[model samples]
Target: MNGMTRIEFLLRLTISNPDVHTAIIGTLNPDHLKTNIAAVAAGPLPTELYTEISDRLAKFSQPK
Candidate 1:
């Protein structure tokens, strides 16, 4: 979704799952790396935000 940021997206993929041990991101640019680090520093998304994202994704996945 356009409203989701890189950090939120990353955390959503990693933090939501207990079996996931790590998430690897590839980036060559310094600025992009910094942003990615900051995203991880922000930690996992709150339950409300996660639920919202899940709901949005569910809607998006449905047949149009």
Candidate 2:
């Protein structure tokens, strides 16, 4: 949702949690692997961004 790419956001989301130590991503294409590497190197999302994402998911994923 921020300036980060969708892949970056997803990876950073996974990396943000203290309980999470590893995230496995599979790819066949070289470019995809490169993008994934860059995403991981970008590191975890900021606390505010992570909380905003979790909050949005909780809000929208509720039964309507």
Candidate 3:
């Protein structure tokens, strides 16, 4: 989404919350660490995208 790499998009999702202080991710691989750093550099998703994702998730999680 938003033409960003999947890692970037997922990292953005992980860090979007103000209440979230830290992220726990696999850090065993040196290359993975570099990828995580790059993803964080890309920052969070746009507000519109975040809101949309939240809304969709809420609906999805509702009893059907």
Candidate 4:
């Protein structure tokens, strides 16, 4: 997510939700207006992928 380009992040989010707002569109350059642009560029994950990641986190967090 950190290394993802602005274009790649938007494309990934759209893949999960076609209704997602496009207001997030903007440049990745560090500037006052570009805030939240980083989140948009982080991309959204599919439900399954998100669930799997959460499960992995739970496993790691369990007491040994």
RMSD (Cα, Å) for all candidates, in order, is 3.9, 2.2, 1.7, 7.8
Q: TM-score each candidate.
A: 0.59, 0.77, 0.79, 0.38
Give candidate 2 misplaced runs (Cα > 4 Å).
58-64
Tell me how far the alpha carbon of residue 20 in candidate 4 is from the true structure, in angstroms, after superposition: 20
In model 3, the runs with Cα more than 4 Å from the true position are: none
Give the least accurate 10-residue stretch of model 2, judged by summed lDDT: 1-10
Window of ten residues with lowest summed lDDT in model 1: 1-10
lDDT of 1 by residue, 1-62 (tens): 34668665765557775668877878799998887777677666677766777787799799
The 10 consecutive residues of candidate 3 with the worst lDDT sum are: 17-26
CA lDDT scores, all candidates in order: 0.71, 0.87, 0.85, 0.57
Better of 2 and 4 by lDDT: 2
Looking at model 4, which ten-residue stretch has the lowest summed lDDT?
Answer: 32-41
* Candidate 2: clashing residue pairs, number: 0
TM-score of 2: 0.77
User: TM-score of predicted model 3?
Assistant: 0.79
Model 3 clash pairs are: none
Which candidate gets the maximum lDDT versus the true structure? 2
Ranking by lDDT: 2, 3, 1, 4
Q: Which regions of candidate 4 are displaced past 4 Å?
A: 1-38, 41-43
Q: Write the per-residue lDDT of candidate 4 for residues 1-64, one digit (tens) a residue.
A: 4465556544564655645555544555667345455445555766775456558768989999
